[model samples]
Target: MAGVGLALRDGGDGGAPLFAAFAGAGAGLALAFSPTLTRAPATVRPEDAADASGLLATVTQLGRLIGVAAFGTLFLNRLESLGASGAYTSAEALLAGMDALALTAVAGAVSGLVRRRR
Candidate 1:
């Protein structure tokens, strides 16, 4: 759904496609959070469950911080290099950042699947 919305973003439909894409992505992330939080601690012994949960939370937060920082840097760099053409440059920067993020996500997913298979 998110992918469909993203692919339709260039249709010039008054931002509806982008909004739907973001909404779907947000919903997907929200849905995954609970199961991930629950499952992380379940892998530990009873006494270590609390510690595992805490570690999972800490790592999740740190990853978010790093991802945001990296994406911000990429966007800013692209925006600057594009010579400040206003909305067009900004859009290009955003697209570049999103593309990088999507690639990173696909690579991570692939690596995770490979590791699980091994």
Candidate 2:
């Protein structure tokens, strides 16, 4: 999912971007069920389960928004900084920004794993 999203471009030969979109869609579908599935076994009462699932969905959406805003700000700052370099095209700046975004995702995944281990 992250891989496919990171691979997207403004335009190019072949249907690579289309393929990436499908991949992203697949990822989204997988993620969509996660909160409900996680709550299925974790919560005891049905009412509590419903509440927890709702809360989970809300938090997940909030997290998504925050991540987008933070990463977008970072990307724009990076692109602005690279603007002065004549050799760097907009496409190149976008790709660089995406690379940085991907790194942050990797960092988040790593931290999640570390936290789980404790």
Candidate 3:
């Protein structure tokens, strides 16, 4: 749903669609985060639970950092290059960034599903 909303964005519509997309993504993450954190420790022995939890937290934070860095780089590069051309606006660059992030999210989800199946 979030992916669909992001992909559909054309940089001309009102804020409602963007808001909905963000809301949907937030809600989905909120729903998935708790169970994932809970389950991570459960897969380990009692004494190892803390280590598992710590590892999970570390990985999660690292993933977020990498994602933010990638997104920022992509967005800023697009903004600078396109803005220089005078043919595209910041909004268009923003939309491009959002679309790239959405595609990345979709790919991650699919890969996770495949890993789980295997």
TM-score of each: 0.77, 0.60, 0.82
Clashes of each: 0, 0, 0
For residues 1-118, could you state the per-residue lDDT of candidate 2 as single tens digits? 3444344444243266658756775775576557545745485676687687677778879988997887778667766776777555455555665666657656866886898699
lDDT of 1 by residue, 31-89 (tens): 75777677667779989877887888899999999999998999899979875655454
Evaluated with lDDT, which candidate comes out highest?
Answer: 3
Which candidate number maximizes TM-score?
3
| lDDT (0 to 1) per candidate | 0.71, 0.64, 0.77
lDDT by residue (1-118, candidate 3, tens digit) is: 4353354545565466666776788887887787777777787998887788788989999999998899889889998999899987777777777788778878977997999998
Ranking by TM-score: 3, 1, 2
Better model by lDDT, 1 or 2? 1
**For every candidate structure, what is the RMSD over all alpha carbons to the true structure, in angstroms?**
3.4, 4.0, 2.7
Instruction: Identify the superior model by TM-score, candidate 1 or candidate 2.
Output: 1
Q: Give the local distance difference test score of model 1.
A: 0.71
